[model samples]
Target: MYKTLIYDFDGTIGDTLPICIAAFKKAVTPFLDRDISDEEIVSTFGPSEEGTIQALIPDHFDEGIHAYWQAYKELQYMAPKAFDGIQELLDDTAKAGFQNILVTGKARTSADISLEQYGLTKDFKMILTGSPKGPNKPENIVKALKETGTNASDALYVGDAPSDITSAHAANIKIAAALWGSIIEPEKVAALKPDYTCRSVADFRQIVLPE
Candidate 1:
């Protein structure tokens, strides 16, 4: 039903939220005298890791990013692998000649680190990382379609976040809520009425790559 698959990275492809949040907290701990709440950090997510730091401590943006990367790379074991079936899904889609594109809320460096650690760097035809300004999925989604010469109708955006659903709809694309990640609230995501609600990557594969 679709010719192109657009993906989200953190909770969607790799179980990365653990390391992301941990690293973020670790990165900002020194600058903050008091403990930082997870919600406080999460609220800064529209921008990339650096942007998050910029929001929290503009004077320490560069230092915060360095600390974040140090912790992120060292804490890789928290997200040691992709969701179980993601590699196969990418492989199968490749064999079927589907265009795979990644639009992630992670900064490019962090995204590259995760992809490199997972040994799945070459899967996407294009990859758009998060901005230092704000969350730009909707605009980036449209940009991905245009860059790939794909029509919105022929593409499906597979993501785990509610914002992802909103972005997909804003870009006039079909959305499949990927509910397989550990940290996501499935019930909340489901309440948004995505075009497809997949409990696992296998379910997503069935819809997009059915024979």
Candidate 2:
């Protein structure tokens, strides 16, 4: 069992992918003459909001981020919901003495809004958001481990993206694939060979807290 659990916010913890894509498209519309594809938007997504914005709208990165969050925050609905059983999982993990930490590409403000909306603001012990000059995901993972006083051997990083897997691996941490929150094909994910593939909450519990 792990003593620390590091999580990715979008897609993994919060179902914000749809709204995020919409916001990205809306953000770039004013700057782009033509439509931007969803794949393009997703591919450019990095560990920080500004990183993604800069990739998408290098000419007007700051303006793009402002517009993106403006559209994103204005929407009351379509923010995101915690995936099925996610709250229970977090609660259980906490009760079992694991330190829950968050590493998100969303700006701290945007991440807080979603966490508050979902009533998950208190679930994490430490939160590392991707601000304009914040550390990237891999760096955040290292920080989470250090802050929580947990070693990589005693920590598990769960996420739904290839980048998350790569980051965890780079940080010398074990990684688990959240199949339920997967955005990529299962075959593709399988090829990445995560230490564990959690198809359901039960699978997650089995791997992280087997008794």
lDDT scores of the candidates, listed in order: 0.91, 0.81
> Roughly what TM-score does model 1 have, to 2 decimal places?
0.97
Relative to the true structure, candidate 2 has a C-alpha RMSD (angstroms) of 2.1
lDDT of 1 at 23: 94
lDDT of 1 by residue, 1-211 (tens): 7899999999999999889889989999899889998899888887788788898878888898899999999999988888899999999898998999999989999999999988889999999999998889999999999988999999999999888988898999999999888878777777778999998998999998876
Number of backbone-clashing residue pairs for each candidate, in the order shown: 0, 0
Model 1 score (lDDT): 0.91
State every prediction's TM-score relative to the real structure. Answer: 0.97, 0.90
lDDT of 2 by residue, 1-211 (tens): 6788899888788668777888888898889889999999877667466777887789998799888888777653774468878898899888988898998878887888788878999999999988565448888899888877898999999888777788888999999987775354567767878998888767887877786
How well does candidate 2 score on lDDT at residue 168? Answer: 88
Worst 10 residues of 1 by lDDT: 183-192
lDDT of 1 at 146: 95
Candidate 2: lDDT over CA atoms? 0.81
For candidate 2, the TM-score is: 0.90
